[model samples]
Target: MTNPTLALTLGDVAGIGPEITAKALLAHPELREIARPVVIGDADAMRRGMRATGFDTDALVVIEDPREARNDPDTVELVQTGPSLADVPIGELSAAAGDGAYRFVVEACSLVRAGRADAIVTAPLNKAAMHAGGHDFAGHTELLAHEFGVKDYSLVLSAGDLYVFHLTTHVSLRRAIEDVTVERTTQVLNLAHGLARALGRPEERIAVAGLNPHAGENRLFGDEDADVLTPAIEAARERGIPVDGPIPADALFPAAMRRGRWNLLVACYHDQGHAPFKSVYGDDGVNITVGLPAVRVSVDHGTAFDIAGTGQANEASMVLSCVRAAELAPGWGAVVDALS
Candidate 1:
């Protein structure tokens, strides 16, 4: 009975991905107590990260196979996955960096699918760089969905007691509004509930945000929030989901996040949730994908290319993301399996 292993994938090599991944494992020794962590990225790039970030390269032990990874707090296990990114420059986008980042994700997912790893905590990958590399996906979620063969999934941003689930992400605002439906709303609520339960919080207070100004103001501003979102919340409450509102988008976040009125808030679209969440939580925000059987968590920010090699990048998000993934991974499979 071994502890579940976590495949920690490095994001964009040319960015701050390698540095943050290294710092997360090094700074947080508690991570070793929960799971066997193995770095899934380019070895050369990691060595460069250590040099740039003033980390002890000797502490990063390169292993030829994932099975060789150990739960040793003193050393970080490295299992190289992608092609060499030696030519890729820091603080800039490169097609080679994109390809490496994409490869690390695919390899990490493969490890989980093969049962070699139990969960994955990914660093940020540059979307434009990956597209230039010919991966041709919008973001990590799309690629994960394609690899895992899942159609129903949601992205959750969590920090402290506040949690937000996006009804639509990585899409245009026009398309995002159209994508919101009764089915998607109900599905995301269940997923958010499952995530809270997996973290041992079963009370699961749920809040639904309005799509219009002040929740349509009784259809004065718009009707979609009342016509579309209200029905979904009503149905959920009838099913005993502990749900409430079509609250005003502006007021809902303040009440839920700052006032502690709710545990989860379902946003109508991307920026509506992300803007406030990131503003308040800053570098502490963590993105958790709830529909997959395996726990998947990631830093809420993107590749900070401008500060990539300056050692100025904050690894707080990375540290929190890994900590949450390890805490949730043990029972995540069972929770998701039961939901399925």
Candidate 2:
């Protein structure tokens, strides 16, 4: 099989997306060997970022086809998605930057749908700027699901060795609690299993975290653990899925991540999973959208508006995003086979 073409969408130009992306491409030596990396953003912005981040390259190779990308150490191929943004200032939000970011994602999706690219890795985008520019989406996960018409989807975050999927994301705390149901939990568990399989762990085990403190303290606080969670676990087990839970959130993380335990954790809400995952992985985590028709992974962090254009943002998360994208591609087995 040919090398999988991984298309990267520069998040928000005004933020650190371009800078960190260029840095990741330059620092990772093995990445250029496994998959043909292609950037779907403004060429000029990428060049500016390369210069700003002090990443020296041989030349800017433009390509019309993903198969034409040269898998050389000094060569980085780019497919221009939007017009030149040479005049757009850094560190300030503008409609042009928002439009450019949106166009990059749409173009990447087109490439993936057309079979030109195997998977997509995205940088961070500012929600406020995107809304102001008429994009009107909460985040990348929602946008991708809408574009592909995928109904069963979950946001899975990988921090170090810990993988977590939330029952609800990008909503208020009260709304997230209210949204918890047996059906939703089961759907998330199934998605988690699929994601684990894609990551080369087909028989991965999953543990579900409870909603309330002490797992509702035996229904003294709330009945969510017994009513919603216990039934979901039982239903999944009936289907032959290896799942265990309604475990207390406090004890779940340590037990799952201890040594040889479960491969994934399904959190009842957002913070219950994220807080522990981020604590271990720091900026090395990647947020992947599971159950989509196409492969899409993103940096777990958001646009650092305060430090925009400062060249201080770390690219570890973006680098991990690329690695995860390569792993999910259909031709990923070739890359892994060659490495092994």
**Best-fitting candidate, measured by lDDT?**
1
Off by over 4 Å in 1: 196-203
Model 2 agreement with the true structure over 88-177: per-residue lDDT tens digits: 778888888888888888888889889888888998887777777789777788888888777788888876556788899878889998
Candidate 1 lands at a TM-score of 0.94
Evaluate all candidate structures by whole-model CA lDDT and list the values in order: 0.84, 0.79
What RMSD does each model have against the real structure?
1.8, 3.8
> Cα miss at 255, model 2 (Å)?
2.0
lDDT of 1 by residue, 72-108 (tens): 7877788888567878999897889889888988898
Tell me how many residue pairs clash in candidate 2: 0
What is the TM-score of each predicted model, taking all chains together?
0.94, 0.89
